[model samples]
Structure formats: structure tokens, C-alpha cells
Target: MRQHGLEAAISRRRFLALAGALGGAAALGGCGGDGGASSSKVTYWVPPNAELSRMQAYLADVKTGFQKAHSGTTLDNVVVPWEDALTKYTAAFSGGNPPDVTYQIIPWMNKWRSTGVLADFRTLDKGFTDTFLNGVNPDYVKAAEGPKGELLGLPYVGGYWVLALNEALWEKAGKPTLPKTYDDLIPFAQAMTFDKNGRKLGESGYDARNVETYGMCWAPSPPIQENYLWHYFWSFGSDYISADGMDVGFKDDAGRAALRHMKAMVDSGAVTPPNLYSDDVRWQAAVMSGKAAMAWSEGFTAEYAKQYPQLRIKVLEPPAGPGGQYIVGACGFLSVAAKARNRSGALDLVKYLVDDKPLQDFNKLILAKPVRQQPSNYYDGLDDPRMTTFMNEAAALSKYVKITRILPYQPQEYLVGKINDFLLGRQSMDAMIDEASKQIKQMAKAAK
Candidate 1:
């Protein structure tokens, strides 16, 4: 959490005093329409990403609509970077002050709750919690719940790693078919690999890589594979943790097979060598510039493509693996600091932000699939065939992705990068896994 210099001005005592004096706040079961974000003025902190910028643009309409329907409320927004979110959030709480409501990645919900930074959302109105999607993957829900099964966050987005195609490039490469299974991808990639000079697919093209373009790129660099690789790991029916989270899963045959497959991709030169800092921006540049042909990317790619008018892109299910189809992530939500300046107002803000309408609107702008399947007015213009295809795939195929509890100890991106290096022969799998397992056991012991 990164804090702004201004946060220091609001002391904890002053903040609690402010909340206590806000007399209109209601008890737990009652809705506080005029007190929450519905208050005359309320603040919201969101990630300062392109996704949020797009939302920021439409916030006026959203504020106006809500204010019009109610009376005097206004929605005030703050933008925070993903890397600095934790520090900022902590600073806010230390002073008994924080935004009325704010979003955090799912994994951190439990972490925050343990520190008593989050409110017990179960105390909210009965049907409020009931409105989320049914049959949501249990593992995904478990990730958001704190100790003793307290639900700390509500998933508004169901993020999954997916295959994206540059149709023009694919057709130029001879309209190769989509891969149905992990093994099938090897040949599909072979067909897609081409060079203006007609050299070996990945390496033979040119020192400058005169190949028409790369077939694909897997990010999270050399010594640590990215979390995205988990989808493939799971496709082999392997997990990073045992069911009880008591032991590492890497020594299992299935886990080794998955690692071997990823290693093979690196060895075969089918993917980009890892770049420690090549985040989504680097990924966008590679695909948008036609330097790379395909990617297993986040759903936001479609949303990003809207900025490039000439680029025609399409989304598809990630190729199935030995275990059938697989996906590796779910959505995340917000948690208010328990010691906020306007505690009641903060809870109200949470309810307001997650109200069906805002979530639907946010999902629409980001081209996200809903965690809840119930339809909303937000989907009105999304009936186009292309949109339908992607949406349907998201609904039926994506699965919740989870990993060993050592997540906090092992920077997720670093872990994936390390694994990639091991597979590339830069390091041995046993040696790498041994190091990772050491970290995992330490975390597991601490968790105990």
C-alpha cells in the first residue's frame, strides 16, 4: 500500500471521531442509501490502470444517474497503482482513515482481514450477499474468504488466461486451425511459424528475426515463470499444492510433465525468452505491432484492441490439455478498512460500488465476464456474434485458478519466471523446485 503525502494529515482519532458523529448511519441489516456512496459525497479508490481510466470517463454519467435516482450523493474517485496499493491502504488505516471503499486483489482480502482491516461483510443485508453468481468455483470463493469462512470480497470479474489470435496474421500464415489440446499446440505453432527468408521456425529466421512474426509469446521472464503458466500446469491435472496445502506438488509425475511441456516450449523457441519487466504494455506492443502472432492473454486484450482501430483480433478458449480445458484465475473485489474515518459510510460505499448496476457497468467497459450469470442492462449492446462467441467461451470453460499457499513468500511472477529458466536448461528442475519448496515449506509452517 502506497500512501499519498496528504494521508498523514488525517490522524486515527480524528477519523474515528468523524465516523461517530455522522448520526444518520443505520444498524447492520438496514440499507443506508443516503449514507454510503449514496451520501452527498463519498470517495472510491481504484487501480489507476487503463481499465479504470475508461471507467473514470463514464463516472459522471454513473454519478448523475445514481444521484438523480436518489438525491444529493456524489461519487468521488481516487486512482492508485497496482504496485503501491497495499502501502496506501495501510497508511489510510493506520490513521483510522481510508477511502469510503476500495478494491484489492483477492489474495490480499484474507491478509487484510487477519489484521482486522476489513469489515465482516456477512453482516450486510441478507439478500445482498445472495445476489452473486451461483455455482462459482469453490476454490475461487475459498480464496476470497478469510479464516472461519468469512466472505471478505465479492468477485465481479472472472479473469482467465485465454488464447488471442491476430486473424489477419493467422490467415496470412495460411489460416491454421486452433489447437484443441496442449499437444496439438506444438504443430499449430509450427504451422504459424514463418519467416520472410523461410528459415527454421523460431530461431532460424534471422539475427534480427526476419520471420514474418512470432507464433506466440509467454511472459514472466527467465528465472520465474508467470502465474499464467498455471493453466497449462493444471491442464496436465497437476497443482502447485497438495489438497491439504501440506506439501509441494512439483514432485508428482503430473506436475513434472507440465513443467516438461513448458520447458519444451522454451527449448523449441516457440515463445519469447522471458523479460523481467515486460508487463502488459510490452505484451500489447508485441501483439499490436504484429511482431508476435498469438498470445495466451487476459480478457482485457479485447478491451485494449478497441484503441487500435486497424488491428483485428479475436479471442478463443485456451487450448485444452490432457486434463481437458482449463483456465487459471478468477475476479477480485473491494474491502473497507475497519478503522475508517466514516466506518458506516465506508460500508455503505462498499454496498454502493458493488450494487448490481455498477458491477454490470464496470464489466461492460472492460469486456469482462461476470462472476454472477444473471443478466443486466449492461449487456445490451454485447449481442454481436463476435462478442457472443467470446462471452460464451468465458461462461462455459474458464475455471478458478489457485496455487500453493506459499504465494506471499514467492513473488508469483518471479516463481513462474524461475520455472521457465529451469525448463530452458538455464537451471535444473530439481534444483529450482527444491529452492521453491524450501520457500513454500517456510510459508506453510508460518501459516500453521
Candidate 2:
């Protein structure tokens, strides 16, 4: 899932509302159609994609392939808008009419699991579990597991957030070397930043207010803040919360250092102001339109190139820090509902969807990497060299990346909002840290 897309659809308010409904939903029973092993039908629910027509065509192909593979079986495909998905799923479960299988992100796992509607794939089919485990990445498998290590979901697609540079801008700046460390990035960005009069940053008569091109851009708003910003924290050796999930983890030296470095970038006047371009589209536009020379992006260079053919974009390795090189990744999963009427048929459909052909096709459609092992057609099918480079870099960096966890509370809004306030000079660094820490602790306590 794209960082902005996921964040926009599931706001803090909506998540809290879903959390409230999950409590009562736990006591509700299933009410959908009953289809035993001999049943001829299985219902599936998927979130809508930005490429609606293409996704519809892909789904149609999937239906044909699935029905052909399983004679006498029918696939009931349904598209659910992400904005209303949580409520719809909750209602479906409460009314006992939930789909047999549905698409889910890592964050929603705990909430739906709490509602007692997700099936434990481990118990449903050991053969399928063993096959899936042997074929898919272990990290994705781990992300799909429940607290007790049960297979609550089957991960299929994944992506990472990395640094993307405007090659033309770098070429114009005398082809300065790419930054390998966090400390190196500021100067690298400043070299590319210029004023309306062509005065480079740090040069005489340069004006920050009249910046014609920014050195870098990053999203610090809700929905994508946690997704994109936390890499800096991880690189600085800080986490938002303790591993046990009981206390604040960012109220430390590393966390403070990370915040200071972020502020320094803003203070350098080489970064696009957070208020000016707060969302993903605007963030990409900053780079595409030559307003910014580089950006923290989720491997969207290929798509950006299509829109602006003249601009040369290059995917770069994530910057390293005292903590080491690190990036954040997220995966999408296909999960079966516990109350599925055709439990056996549902399992079959899940396994079928993960098979090589369908899985690779789905990943290609979304421009995501398949969760399965590589050396397959998926990699060979990538037409863009930049996309291939991105895939290769992502695979090499997978060892340093961590899949986002299933947290008890949504922590993006509180943490990112305070950081933005500090960057914008509305609050002191100390105040931002203290206030954010307090809110996080309260959220954890309340979740219990």
C-alpha cells in the first residue's frame, strides 16, 4: 500500500471509532452463507485501488483463472472502498454476514482479530501453511502471525520507503556524490538548493524566502508521518515505544538527536516547508517539477517518470546513521474470516490467490514486490530499469528493514504532530518531546 493512500483512508478518528465497535463485535456470531466442502461458491472482498479500470480487469482475469482451476466453483468478488472498509467489516461481522476472505493491512490485524472474526489459518489447513511458509519471506510470515504465532493472515505484496533523487538536479550541481550518512545529507541537499536569482544556498545574497528549488522534501502530516518519518528514528537507534509496548521509547538521547537532525534540515532552508506540500502527491510534485532535488519516497520513481519523461529520477539507498542503515516496509495480506460458511472453499481460494501466476500479476499491478522468493517472472517482467534497480535495492535492504508492527494504538498523529510543531517553530524541542511522550504513554495505558 502507498503511504499516503493508507494513511488518508484510515484516520486516527476512524481507527478509534473502529476500536470502540470491536468490543461489542467480539460477542457477536457469524451470519453468512454456509458452503461446505461440496459448496460451489466463495465470497472475497478487496480494497479499491487508484487504478480502478486496471484492477477490475485484473480481478476479472483472476476470477477466470480461479474458476478454471477449481471446476464447479464460483468466485464472488467485491470491491470495498478503504474509507468505509473498517466499518463495513465490523458491521458484516456483527451481522454474521462477513466475506469468506478479505484484504488487510498489517495495522488492522489486531483490531479484526480482537473482534473474533479472523480465522487461524494454522488450524484451518496445515498443508497450506507449510507450503506458504516454504515459498514466502519469513519476515512477512512473521508479520502475519497473531500474538500466539497463529497464521491470521497470508502476506502477498510488500514495499519500502527510500531516498529518491532527481538525477538532472544532481548533474546540474556538478554531480556531487550521493550521501551515505545522515550527517552528509544536509550539505548534499544544500548544494542543489538555489534562489530565484540562481544564487545557491550558502552563497552571498542567497535568499531562503525566494528559494526557486528546494534540496529535499518529506511528508510530516497525518496518515504518512509514521510510515515515512520513523525511518529517521530507527536510524538514530530510537523507537516510538518499548518492545513490550508499555512505555515511551523516544524520550532518549537517540530520539532527541533524530529530532535535532530533522530540525537542522528545516533550519538549513533547503527542505520544502512541511506546510507547503504535506501529502504524497505534493511531495512527489516537489521533485518532479524541480521544486525539490530529492525526496523521501516509496519507490514511485517509475510512476513519476511516466508523468514527466524529461526528468531523470534515481533511487538511492536510505541514509545511514549512528544506529545504522534502516528503512520501514509494509505488507498486504489475504485473511479468511472465522465465520466463513465455506471454510474449506475459503482456504482453497486463499491458496489459489497466492499461487505464482496470480500473486505475481497482483504485485505487478500495484508495482509492489512479491512476498515469495525471487528469480521468478515477477522480477523479469519489470520493464523499467529504475524499477528493477528499486527492486534489487529493496531486496538487499530487506535485512535492514523492519515490517511495521501491529500496535495497540495508532501513534502517527500524536508523534508526528508534535514533531511538525517543533519544526515549524511553534513549540520548543523539549516541549515537543515531553508532550508527545505523555500522550503516547496515555494511549498505551488506555489500550489496556
**TM-score winner:** 2
User: How far off is model 2, as Cα RMSD?
Assistant: 5.4
Candidate 1 has a TM-score of: 0.75
How do the residues 299-396 of candidate 1 rate in per-residue lDDT, one tens digit apiece? 43453446555675666666777765655554556665454444555556666656777766666665555554443333555635445444555544
Model 2 accuracy (lDDT, Cα): 0.71
Q: lDDT of all predictions, in order shown?
A: 0.56, 0.71
> By lDDT, who's the top model here?
2
Instruction: Tell me the deviation in Å of residue 187 in model 1.
Output: 0.8
Residue 229 in candidate 2, Cα distance off native in Å: 1.6
Q: Which stretches of candidate 1 lie over 4 Å from their true place?
A: 1-43, 49-54, 72-77, 80-84, 133-137, 198-210, 220-227, 243-247, 273-280, 299-308, 336-352, 374-408, 443-448
RMSD of every candidate to native, in Å, equals 8.7, 5.4
TM-score of each model, in listed order: 0.75, 0.86
